[model samples]
Target: MTSPITTLTLDGLETVYDRLAQAIDRAGEDKRALFLVKLALLNAQALGDAELFQQQMEKALLNL
Candidate 1:
């Protein structure tokens, strides 16, 4: 069975956004894409649901 996704609080989201921005900066322009792909793959593996990950990816693509 698929587990319900946990929603992050506003404060938690802000913290994560800040950390992600910092990490992207550290990854540098030359390798930021690679860094993000690696991060996404790791997160997807942890999530343990490829279908859910694909759905999330689709949601993320909206309004971008």
Candidate 2:
């Protein structure tokens, strides 16, 4: 019983993860870590996982 928007968001997240992985491979470890943090946040928001979202935000801040 997933909505169209939800389905689209999941697909978008997959695409974003793929692109981020490629970018990380081309760049450096730090950049890859940052992208991963971002991906986690986006995933949390999309799935209404507030605890994960906050944890990811904290991790991202620590990285910065």
Best by TM-score: 1
Which regions of candidate 1 are displaced past 4 Å? 1-4
- Model 2 poorest ten-residue lDDT run: 1-10
lDDT tens digits by residue: candidate 2, 1-64: 3323333488898997798678779767767777766766677767676765587578868946
Q: List the residue pairs that clash in candidate 1.
A: none
55 in model 1: Cα distance from truth in Å? Answer: 0.3
lDDT of 1 by residue, 1-64 (tens): 6567898999999999999999999999999999999999999988889988999999999999
**What is candidate 1's local distance difference test score?**
0.96
C-alpha local distance difference test of each model: 0.96, 0.69
- TM-scores across all candidates? 0.92, 0.39
lDDT of 2 at 32: 77
